[model samples]
Target: MADGHHWNIVKIPPIVQELAAGVHEPPSQYMVGEKDRPAIAGSDMPEPIPVVDLSRLFASNGYGNDMVVSEKQILNWCDRDVLREYTVRCREITSLVLKKLAKLLGLSEGYLVDMFDEKAMTYARFNYYPRCPRPDNVFGLKPHSDASVITIVAIDDSVSGLQLLRQGVWYDVPIVPNALLINVGDGIEIMSNGLFKGPGHRVVTNAESERVSLAMFYTLDPEKELEPVPELVDDEKRPRQYVKVKTKDYVTGLFETLARGTRVIDTVKISDNLNEIVS
Candidate 1:
């Protein structure tokens, strides 16, 4: 991507994925007053990114060269090896994470890993916020929890806006520079029988500089059903805390609930547990 040569998106037609559904009127959520966009990949930009790619980045998904993605999930990009390696590494990292979480819950190491099949889906979402003159007026993202089993956010720039809700107040998440933030999602909370809780977070606009955050969402097959794992739910203390639902249905309901400005995890809970998780 450092090369000065520009690529045409008119031919391949890069993916124009929407971060939010139904409110698709030029992604005003990501807009800021036109200024200099800071370098996302750390220092030294050797060349200028073409207008087509830059517009796409500003239009929700382009990010200079969004050729790496499509609704089909497989575009004929020359640098496909990077995407392949990225997905493979994500699988390995998340698999290890699940095993550790399973052990933490006193369940078998492979217990949670077995739930996510080979056909499961993984998605990469990138949100770019240009330097805003009126930071108080705009919000980059609203307070919502992920619908996936886990969401890993790679902070690509120095500007800070991510914040988490705790107890009753919102706290800014400190930037660690090139660090990844691992978030517990709604699916994990269900599988753990409410032992784990998803976090509520939002992104406020920053007046200093531009920022880009790349989030990876890992989910089970759309057809797979999820519930409080049988091992975690017993006749004793830990009864079934979550209602069983297919992945597709839950995801559909998640979008709907988000649109309604409510947390979907609360809707799926059969018992009143961790009501403080997301509010």
Candidate 2:
């Protein structure tokens, strides 16, 4: 008899084992573009950012209080060391997630493990535009999909503003208390051979309150070449699309696009020399 639910205890991975075990650091300042940014929501709104506890993310798997992550710590991720530690934790959790997804997809566990090892990870913060006298005039965040493998988000539960693009329509994603939202990033789609999709999403701000979210980005390994898995490619009128790329060069290309403030994925440079993977 199966209850249809799989369970496993989770713990901090060895990559971040040293960092999380070290002394704590002071909180750093966090802000959006400016202090007096115009409002994106209407004047009647309160703060839109919600609160979440990522410390308990693996609690169900028995990691419990042994792993504690504070909201303030995530808010100040300017420290590269802190960001690195957070990224490691992100990959650790995502490894579990990828395994589960692989099982469902009938893919081998080794494949999933390899995918995790070949991935790059990073941590970033999304700050809601500050409250202005007028809300409709401002946009806290524009809709976009992360250009990575997977994205784990610990959002502020008190404020509700994250929306997902579904069937070409925007739908509000309710931020339940104490829950983290897992969204498939572009890389996952490529790895999964398009089985899982990276949907477009965005955040709206409250006229009087600020909204914040911490995003963990997991990327493909820079030394590896990425192409659609043959097993996942089936005949469907859609053409079999594959782009070869080196993960390091791919990421550098991504930063170049970000510097230009462009959201077009097509503009990203893919390495034709993807076969040059180093051992």
Candidate 3:
């Protein structure tokens, strides 16, 4: 079993931290002193969070060793070598974690890996939350479930604010220095036939200290079909709890629904009787 302390040795690269500090975006709605600022759509926030698409670093063959960034600003500030090294390390970690998850779910070690094609998408976001005047009234981020297969979050251990909702209650996620937080996303829930739930989580703001976190999300090939594994579904025992859909379509719906303040997962969920009949 892997404990939080076990990941304490994996530190965030200094260049990544430097880039995060240099990339400034407009204040988010959650900040109390930003009342004078005009509200903007979540997607069009004045200062957009900096995101690096690791997939873009690869060539058409998907095995190229060279790394490149299309954004001039990012390219100028980031160290390409360091970025490549970090991306490679994160990819390896993701593969190992997926294999372990497969074993725990009684599936072949490569089962989940196959779902992620050579063109599988990997994204990293650098989140910087400024200190808020009234932390009690605002949240750093809204409550929502991740859309990827899995997410790895590395937080600035000096400050603590992450929380997850479980069984009608919200629990604080402890901050462990150098520790990585693993979150099961919606795709995993669909692939696992609802056996592994993607919990809803949110971030709270602090009155005194600002917070920084780096999150990497791993997703399957968009063109691939997403459905429950047959091995986990029995005609009479376990049933397929979600309808089959393309990964891209599911993700599109997820975002569309989120924009409307609703969840799309339930919309595709198979009802008890329907699930049994389909199985």
- Highest TM-score, which number? 3
| Candidate 1 collision pairs | 56-62, 57-63
Over 136-172, each residue of candidate 2 has an lDDT whose tens digit, in order, gives: 4334565566777778888887886777766755667
Model 2 error, position 150 (Å): 1.1
Q: Between candidates 1 and 3, which one is better according to lDDT?
A: 3
**Per-candidate TM vs. native?**
0.70, 0.60, 0.72
RMSD in order of candidates: 14.4, 16.6, 15.7
Give the Å error, residue 143, model 1.
0.7
Ranking by TM-score: 3, 1, 2
Instruction: Output the worst ten-in-a-row residue range by lDDT, candidate 1.
Output: 48-57
Runs of candidate 2 exceeding 4 Å displacement: 1-89, 126-128, 234-239, 248-279
Model 1's alpha-carbon lDDT is: 0.71
CA shift at 60, candidate 1, in angstroms?
A: 42
* Error in Å for residue 243 of model 1: 0.4
- In model 2, what lDDT does residue 261 have? 46
- Ordered from best to worst lDDT, the candidate numbers read 3, 1, 2
Supply the global lDDT for candidate 2.
0.60
Mind giving the per-residue lDDT tens digits that candidate 3 earns over 1-279? 366454446675575436545534424643334442212212222332344343443335755464324754554556768756777788777777787789889999988877777879887887887766656656677667888898988888898777776775666776666667778888889888889998887778766678999888888888887788888877677777898888789778877877665677787799986965666
